[model samples]
Target: MKKPKKPKRPMLAFAVTEIDDHTGGIVWARTKKAARIKGAARWGYDEPAYVTCRREPWADRFHSKPLPVWVMVANGWHFDCLGCGIRIDEDLPNWQDRCGADDTFRDMLREARRYRKWTPQCVIGHQHSDVFCSQDCKDADDAYRAACKRKEAHAISVFQAKVLKRFPGVTLVTDRDRMHPHAYATSRKRGIVVQQVSVEFEFPGMRYGPASLRWDSPFSSSYRKVEKPYFSCCNGDRAAFEAYAAATRRAAQEPTDRDHP
Candidate 1:
């Protein structure tokens, strides 16, 4: 015997009435029960969790009242296939219908034995992104980010060597300590620090760049930002600290008001 199909209900906006919070999330669903499920799922909780969902009409508008008002909320999550850019939401029939004639989604179900997502990653290192549709896309992105990071590390080392050699006493900054660039330098005036040095400054293979050097201010208890680097290296090479060194030299040579007196 052929099973009877469930009649489709009109999707409408159902407002969740809250007790304490004035603003709550507006959920769209066909029925009251569907609203509860969808809204709870959206908030990463069970249907009967903290939210006391009610069957409010679609015409209900959210207001800025003190308490017990219809509320709408959102987390700003994008549920789309990273590789193909298709809207991926298993709970929504409309979203599922778009995957017709494409078996990639089915493949996702078959292989993802533990967790199903347009969310999980292909590798441990890929945290900035997770909604890949295929292993190929994930691997490619992971490899690309790794390569770019390698380039950045290379650039950092190159900058460090240049500073240490070019300026006899100038040293490299370490992540852990606010160690001065040079041994005798006071805490108020550390020699030099490289910042925002990344491989993606070049993009493509994204091999790093636009590194800047800033010195600790002798006048104040803050690091002075270099407004204009004498030399900016997007690829993280040559003249990385030349402008900084020159500026330091110039500042040193200038006579103070005490000299005039």
Candidate 2:
């Protein structure tokens, strides 16, 4: 009779419970007790060590596996296939082999292996490889930015409206291109078109003077006249506009008194 063949030794697996400097590792073992013994030898006294087994993948697609395996808990590594919810060895040979379904799977696996992070999601909750989930998300973000710009423009318009309401003779000077809001007032008696006192709404806090404001004008001579003096007010300060109107009226009256004298 042929000599009896010795039974093949079962494949052994060991999970890294702890390593030097709070790292993790894996080892093959002949038995569960032996695996634990090896882990203790490497990690020192009272460190965690375990005998783990590998499991087959549930499905063969990247999209099917939305969550990631290979997690770190208290400086210890844990391995589980998120798709199948099965315990796996640290090397993850079974899971990695199953991920070779398609190019997308390979790419996703590469990213997961490289960064050890899952796919990113947008603020609105769609997941993607990039910042946004799709073109629609990008468009929505763009629309949000545009709405903010329009709101700022509306604020400037509302401020201009308040100024015009307070000073009846003033009109927004559309003919002159400006970085900030600009308006002019025509003196009914003097027939002189002088720029009304307006604040620079662009930045650096609204202040008085034509130099404080910026504008584009083909006829630079038009704005050559000194800006009518008025009490400076903080931007969007309605009470300040009221005071400015009163001061301007007083200034106009004083000039007229001098002229008549």
- Candidate with maximal TM-score: 1
Q: What does candidate 1's lDDT look like per residue over 223-246, in tens digits?
A: 554332122344445444445456
Give lDDT tens digits, candidate 2, residues 26-133: 444556566566666665464344222222122122222332222221123333332233333333333455454565866766545643432222112211122232
| Model 1 TM-score, all chains together | 0.31
Identify the candidate with maximal lDDT: 1
What is model 1's C-alpha RMSD?
19.4
User: In model 2, which regions exceed 4 Å deviation?
Assistant: 1-133, 171-178, 182-208, 211-244, 247-261
Q: List per-candidate RMSD values in Å.
A: 19.4, 23.2
Error (Å) of candidate 1 at residue 50 is: 15
